[model samples]
Target chain A: MTDLNRRHVLGLAAAGLASTVFSPLSAFADEKELVIGGSIPLTGVFAFAGVAIEAGISDFVKITNEAGGVAGRKLRLAYEDTAYKVDQSVAVFNKLTTQNDIHLYYGDSTGFAKTINEELNRRGSILMAGASFGSELNNPEKYPFQFMAGPDYVEMIAILLEYIAKQQKGAKIVFVNSDTEFGRDPIEASVKRAKEMGLEVVGQIVTPPTAVDVSTEILKLRRANPDFTIFHGYVLAPLPEFLSQAKQLGLKSRFMGTFWSMDNSLWANVGAPADGYMGVMPYRYYYDTAPDAPILEKIRKLRPTYQATGYMQGFLTAMLMTEAAKRTLDAGKDLTAKNLKAALNTIKDFDTGGIIGVPISIPGNSVPVGRIYSYSAADKQMKPASDWISLKK
Target chain B: MRIATAKETYIADEGLLTTRTQRAWMIVLALVLVLAPFVLNAYWLYLACLVAINVASATGLNILTGYTGLVSLGQAAFMAVGAYAVAFLDGHLGTPFLLNIFAAGLVAAAVGVLVGVPSLRVKGLYLAIATIAASFILHFVFTNWVSVTGGMSGVNVAPARLFGIELASPFALYFVIVPITALMVLAAANLFRTRIGRAFIAIRDRDISAEVLGIPLLQYKLMSFALSSFYAGVAGGMWAYFFRVVTPESFPFATSIFFLAAVIVGGLGTILGPILGAAFMTLVPELLKYVVEWLGPVFPNAGAALSPVRTIVFGALIIFFLVFEPQGLAEIVRRIRRFFHLWPFKT
Candidate 1:
């Protein structure tokens, strides 16, 4: 060959060799592995929740692998940081759908979940189990591919409102929420339910997501002095501030929140003041009484950083995912997204043991309608307040 | 002696790939863009539509940052303005898609002019801060102005349609976004060859000199702001229409940073650079995702570590390009062609 031709051949060979060496994992990725992608916001504002969710997923994958995995094959979960940005989330979703054999997606936030639902509806390849309990996620008619790990936001709020109404006899409630979809859905639904139940909604205040000081809003609530305060918001850093401010304002009324406020860290920051805070969750984290509760113990043993409350709830979510995977395998079907969705729909009365008091199902448009858990500031524990309550569809 | 050789080489650097090649490439791009839907899958069409929108936004940003030497991180806010504008018009008046999009752009341009009023005095980091604050203020309005902007729940936008044909499909939207993007890019590219364009270049190099030459500095600055915001507004309209929804969460502060990063990494001050930058910023993370997916098993703790590493690598890559390849990939391609033409001669 001429020198130029020989040089071109050599360069091509070198490029090929480099790609093969650097991307050796790509070769093995094609072999018998079910890649389930988790699109979480690992970098941005919601990084804390994203980390907790991923930790739950990681621990679950580890447990499954140790127990011989699903259908005698190992399970892999990959995560991409959407940074809580829709464009970035869309990019991650595209990467998961186009490049990988990602049958399932998890950990997308509320807005992102809505966007992903629209995309998944377009190409019916991926089914999702996500951290978001937005009412949209539970709309089986709209998003057939999406299944929630917990009660819908509306259900959770209704349950909390109902619990408060029972406790206070005729409690005056105020709904304070960030103006995000995560905060608005529950308040909107619960307020209507509260009116229906003859519980007075004294005041409603909507604050911005980046409100560093919610003192004004707190003052408004304090002035109203509602018997119960339902904080339907995701205030990771500012939650403690809100609680402390409310305490300073001498609002002795009870404070409560949706699932995101169930974290111990939120309570730990405010101390004794956060004592009366209650949150509605799908499962009981500190429960030790059920027969099939070994998974809870196993999770605590493996992930020591995982406390009993939100971590266990997230772990139960992952456990539910594994059980659904097992059901898919039992049907002798390929672990495709469609088959997984089918398997999940067939998940009727899945008893999560003592971890969750009630048996949960996914087939219907209904949520499991979880119970209320009150946080004890002195003990730093979340305990179940009532039995699981089902609501009207 | 080396300087002499370099100076001598500059005369011979001109190649056959001039205006003809440029026009030829544009024609090829137009054809490929026209036929892209027929060849690529649904997902890719979606991605392409996004790319076109980014291209439109970046083109406007390129005019400000690349042509006029300004740094602003409020492009996303402009997009929000355009998107909300489209949503508002469509919801209230039942306006058609094309008219609404243009109206949205016009509104954004108006906002851009309002923001640029401070630019009459502010410069450098001060100007950047002003623009950054403008973005936050815009977000505040969107989040707090519930009656108009729908607060955080976001207004569900109506799809863009023409001649009774709904622009609902990704392919249909692609045709809408791509052609406008092409027109904007071509317009911007050709604009640089005009007096106002040269005036922009002059201002970019040294504002004092341009002002001395009577380029009407304030007028041109406001024009830059108006033009840049118009592009962002159009992109935002596309975003709302294509996604079939609009929420405050869709346009976060990070989006502005993403645009700035795309411009910087793609090749600041060049038309091709923003496109290259947008593609890099968009595609690199995607490529990293597959890489992480494939290598996820190698380390059981891969999920925990891969994302941070990708970000660190992204930062490092940007720095590397800025330091080692300041002219960007476009310049690198130019250098390679130069090298090939000058083959058989030693440096």
Candidate 2:
């Protein structure tokens, strides 16, 4: 303390801090290139899906640029990792939107999209597309510039319940979902819809999507002993835990799930118990053909690997945004968020090849369409349990 | 260049801002805070508001961990209590914004006392584990109490109204948040001047010795918990107003760790530590993003690598700070202050 030169240390510290002062001022937009930015959950609970989603958007941009840039302006996509935290997402949101003046923004989750809703409105300059399918996001009236690529959580629930009703009337059922916004997204509405369809819901269990041991939850479900159980708000862990335990306990009920849990990878985890498990998914699995699964084909050609629903959602979000942007320029309107959103509304009979069945159009910022598929232990694949279901209402 | 002699009275010497220099610095800082909103753009304003909310919460943690030496990892859970309290009451009663903040603090303080019950017997790592259990239980409640807590879908908080204007934007929230945070920080600093504050320090230094001195360990410990939780509650309420959404994910276990890290890195047992720590932790990610952005031209897949790199850098920085500058950023400030004050003197 006595011998060291304090002035030099202070000067060094000041110099170190000086670099930081200029950092917040970084990434001023390039006037010539069109910009799109996003916050992805690169390192947190959703990292597995986040990586795939990031690839989807980036690949689309790459392939599009190869063909020729959109509207003669090369599209530049910039993104930051949120680590699946809302605060970080909001920080990234502000930094990207304000500093880069990005024309379109992508978000990682339902919570982020909902939290940043007000800021998006106030800025009124960028269009927001997210990986979430929350029903709240379906309201174009409130969030005019916000859009999702698939059916809203509510619509997916309705579609599943309608399929369940078709299978057997007066069926006894159990509702099991993760205790997350994604899990709880369709419960109340599904309950009401079930009652309307004359299906008896025997039990409803809400556990964490990541819960590894669900014996207690299984015991609760066993008390109800319903004929069927539907799951929501999960991808891998808790679903397998719940399903495998239910199998060990010799529960005769058929298991089902929504889009998130319908991954092809999930079967490997649940193993033999996955034989009769069925669920709803908006996009066809990797094996589907004819309409050119453009994104999936590209992913396979380069990496030679399997794909999942997250990739589809990410690809379609970027696709729709690009389509909307293209339509704006095609109509000779300025390439602004306002014009892009308006042009997006008029997307009619858009043949998405075979990725999501043909002749698809966004109605109310959602696709509002899905199909029911059941896992076959013998064939090791998802067989169509029900035809394509559309809930225009 | 000597400007003053030693103080004759204890009161003058013990005041929160003891010297004329500190008072002047305070004035300058306040002026900057009030003026920053008008000058900073939307992004910086948003960042500033988030930092203020975090600082408010971090100050509370500093009281418990730094000063009192109880390592409770439920800061974010307490914040959830405060946040949900404000969200529910504001929706049902339509209470004034300030009142909601107070009520939020009180509710969080109540939960804090419950969480503190286990700390009576457990200390060190056990106490931390106990608090982690408490956090999980509270998370379960926040998610399952669907009728009241809105389950996992999370209930939305209506925009706060102040003088017939909505405090919806980050810029609009600055006025409501920054002043409250400042007052809370000042109040925390002032608490150390009282008997309660000394009792906390005594208990932290040696609970047995403090009990021998008739400090009433359990009562003071619980009181510290309540006080710390109250600060967290208020900050969470401000968070709700700023973010305009309340969900379980908003205040996860990671957030509690984030606050504890801030207190540790800012300089434990110092009033200025939490402030510095919270700001540094919050801004580091942004700075990392900028670092990655600088590399954008060099790397095509840098976007995919940004998150892992940020995480690595964050972990590395924390380790570096703990190993090398264990006294924290506050100590560095102290060194600078000492150097400036004793300049050109041969003491």
Candidate 3:
């Protein structure tokens, strides 16, 4: 052998390092295993929802495996943190898909869902669901391989509007939304729907997502002085400020919100100010003691604490994905996007063991179902105020 | 080892590759660029395409901030203009993608000229703030211009088609994006050899002195902005093709800061700086992912616990580079090349 020089050693070490890092880590994957890949936003702005979503998916995977995974195949979850960035999310997507035979995917944001939709169609293998309830992704013709766990943003707003219509005839309404894609998603559609329902829309207040002070917006809200104010797009923040300021102004308008802002624990922190605040919730609350909910009991036993609405969303998403896969396998078919999506649509009035409070069906890319819940300060919980409302009906 | 060489002509002295070794290395680099798509996997090809687009944009930012002494935070806005232009042309007119990209560059250049008018009055941080305001205005236009920009939903661009073949996959897009990036970088390198480029450098060194030398400040400043934003617009067109969708949220303010940071970290005012800086910045986060994965056995929830650490580490690395290698990665590369040139001999 030739003499071992320093340069040769360094070159060899670099080669070894590259090989170790780039080699396929999934080479040892079992044939009886199915992968559920995710681009999770475990860090950055959406970390709160991301953390809970990760846990919910992980817990579902574990529970399914323990009970013998769908069609004798074990379930595996491979995920990376995206920091809620579109490019980073795409990178995570490319990395995970390259390493695994993933048939199901979970995306973090609307931007991600849109960016990856073309790639999903090109692959023709993977079906996806995401944290985004953007109304744009609810089209079956455009996005055949993608679905959301519950109602799209517009449908959520529609559910709330229906509730308002039932409570009062031609109630004057105002919309307060963040100036974001998510916030603006339901506005135009909900406005039209509210008009169709004979409710008068008085004003629309748009605020920046990061606005700390809503003094000007409050002035606008005071001017409108509608019977009801519906807030969308934000998880927390300015809502509390809006609530407190609206109270100080002694405005008679009842405040409301949609899916992302309806969590009981979130409003509980706001105390009395959040009391009587209402919104549309697609899934049952964690502490929901309804007689039909076996899933809630299982969840409570697994973790003795209140899970966020995001957790319910994630859990329901996993359930729907698994059910689709199971139905595809049961029909002795390959898990191609077409077959799996067809199987998903076949889910008519499927029972969720109390997760959804009522049997849910998937007519298209969305469930289009929700119930209005009001937050009570004394109990610090979102008590159900309306029966389960399905837009499909 | 090369000791010294005497040049007989100015052309010889100013040559991009004066030494024989450099010419040989250039050939080798060409070969590697050609062979890379074949050898790299799908994920790496995706990253390569992304890096090429970033390099193009960062090179544009470097032209403005590093060479022309004009700080801008509107690179992303310019890119958005290009992306939207391409999206509209491709979606509405069904024109060829190359034509769409060229049109995108022109539109962005026009906007850049408008935005650059303030650079004549304010500079440094003030100029940067002005650019920031411009970006916010552009963002508002993109958000509210419902008829043209598709409002908040944004527009989806179809895959670039060449000879009826769709360039959808990373492997296919690699051919289109890489060559365009290479040509843009080459054009930037050649720019400094011209009178306009020299004027930019002169303005960067001292505007009053440059004015004394009879170089018109407004003309040169606007030209520099146009050229820089043209480069950015072309890159954004490539980005639109690569991502196949362009939303208002796609090119946020943070991305502008990202390109600026890349220029500083890659060694500003150098031909090779932006390329090195963009590649280094892009790969660092990806490398950290591997590092986190490697530590998984030792720490089960390392993904959650160390995920935030990756951001911290990224910040720390930037700081470390700023403090230690103030001139950036290009200087380090020069030192290594110089050491190799005079190997076995003490400098």
Candidate 4:
């Protein structure tokens, strides 16, 4: 052989780089597989929810396949860890969609959902649902291809408002939310709803998402001293301190939260301080053993530990997605976004196998149904405190 | 070995590509760019568009921090200004995409001049802190300015239309983004051949000395800032078009640090630095992602387990480059070119 010089090596490297970049990617999934793509935040700040959500989706897919699949076509999950960043989420969307014949997608955040809405409308192939309960996404006109598993943030707060209206007439309420899109999502709408329900809006306090020492916010809370304090847009932080300090000051205000912070395991970390803390949750808890909830029982048998509320949300989202797919295929129509979403809208009084305490209907983009659950320090669980309340009613 | 290149005239001597080989290589690059979209898959095209946007922003950062020696953590903020401007113009006025991008650059440049007023009084890390403060102020404005920015909910951007065809997909956008990035990079490379560019260099070396050499420090500094922010603004406009949404949280403070790190790691003060740096920075995470996927069969839950490790490896790679290759990947390129120039000769 001729001398293998550095020039030859360099030329070969350049050729390799070009070929790798330019090589066409073939479709990875066969026609029999209905791919469910996900931009899951398996890392970064949202990883706690992400891990559970991934497991939830995976378990649902496994269970569905074992039960004879959706309309005889196996469900395939193609996902990537986005680390909860919008750019990464978009990147994952592009990559997964390009590689697979995806008809359903699960987004991670409100930002990603919103950012990809235009693209979704343009593609008209995939229908999306996500962890976002942002009030803005509730509009089907703007986000036609997108839907959520539960009530939007506003409806979640409205459920709480309805409960409070029944429990105590004209209850003075204070809104404590973080300074974020997620935090501010339901404040304005919920405030209007609260007034409509004849509840008095006492004060609104906005704290930075990174606020570790909420001393000043607590001082504001003391001044408001409403009958009920509703916290939004936060998963865990500052609420524990807020509750502990409010208790220290002997404030009689009842602390409440929305879906995200309503998880029993999350509040259990605060122990006795989380006692009597209440929030609106759209789904049954992991340990919830109501006679109607066969799905929860099946979930418990699969994993013998307390699953976070995120797991339930993910499991239910997957269940709804596949149900839509099954409906579309059952109608003998193509699996286009329009067909899938149209089929989804046709769902009324649908059973979630007791994932929800009651039969639910997707009147629009959201389930618009939730029940108030109070955290008990003694049992370390969120016990149902109210009957299922639907926004349509 | 080949010894010397003879220049016949002053024009020939001052030319950017003094050798025929360089011009031929440039032609090859141009050909590659022209054919890229046709050959590459959608995922790669998407990445290419993203890399182009990042390259544009990183080049702007390189101009200020590398050429003018004024550090800024406000590049992302300037970009945000551009993105918001494009979104507003496109939404309200229904202006053409090109005009919206150009107007966005002008708006960001004006903001840059205001932010750079402190740079005259402060240099080095102090100047960096000032830019950081400016970034925070801009973020607050983006968040609170409900009428213009749509508050935290933000506004959706209409896809760019070129001659009545919507450039919505990454495949369509590749042509728009890549050519614009190439032109911007070219303009930046040509900037160093001008009087303003020389002034920037002199200021970078020593601001007092540059002043002694009859350069007005504040004017030149502000000019540099305007030019840099203009570049960043244009990049941000492109970003808005690509993503089709402009939220307040689009450009976080961490993004500024990313561009700064790109400039430093790519080889500070070099023309080729930002291009290579931005591409390297953008692609490395993607490469790491593939590596994790490859490890999936061997290691269980590798995607989840190695996700954090990918971030650590990214940080470590930057540190490694800073330690081992201070001049960056550009220097490596130069060394390889030199080795090729005298190949097969034991000099």
TM-score of each: 0.83, 0.90, 0.97, 0.96
**Which candidate tops lDDT?**
3
lDDT, model 1: 0.76
The per-model lDDT (C-alpha) reads 0.76, 0.85, 0.92, 0.91
Using DockQ as the measure, name the better of candidate 1 and candidate 3.
Answer: 3
Please list the residue runs of candidate 2 whose C-alpha ends up more than 4 Å from where it truly belongs after superposition.
A1-32, A168-170, A219-227, A249-251, A266-273, A291-299, A334-339, A376-386, B1-5, B17-28, B114-126, B133-137, B144-148, B339-347
Q: What lDDT tens digits, residue by residue, belong to model 3 across residues B1-347?
A: 77566789999999878888888999999998899898777878898999999999999988899999999999999999999999999999999989999999999999999999999999999999999999999999999898879999999999999888989999999999999999999999989998988999999999999999999999999999999999899999999999999989999999999999999999999989999999988988887887898798899877777888998999999999999999998998898788888887955
Write the residue-wise lDDT of candidate 3 on A1-393 in tens digits.
999985699688678657844676557366798899999998889988998888888888989999999999999888999999999899999988888889999999999999999999989999999999999999999999999999999999899999999999999999999999988998998899999999999999999999999999999989998999999999998999999999999999999999999887788889999989999999999998889998889999998988888898888899999999999999999999999999999999899889897898898999988999999999888999999998954
The native-contact fractions of the candidates, in order shown, are 0.35, 0.70, 0.60, 0.65
Task: Please list all clashing residue pairs in model 3, or write none if there are none.
Answer: none
lDDT of 2 by residue, A286-391 (tens): 7665345564566567556777677777777888888888898888887676788988888988866466775678766888889999998887788888888988
Clashes of each: 1, 1, 0, 0
Candidates in descending lDDT order: 3, 4, 2, 1
Model 4 has a DockQ score of 0.72
Q: List the residue pairs that clash in candidate 4.
A: none
| Model 1 alpha-carbon drift over 4 Å, by segment | A1-35, A58-79, A99-103, A265-273, A286-292, A301-348, A366-368, B1-49, B85-103, B140-150, B157-179, B205-212, B323-346
lDDT of 4: 0.91
Residue runs of model 4 more than 4 Å from their true location after superposition: A1-20, B1-3, B8-10
Candidate 1: Cα lDDT at A358: 68
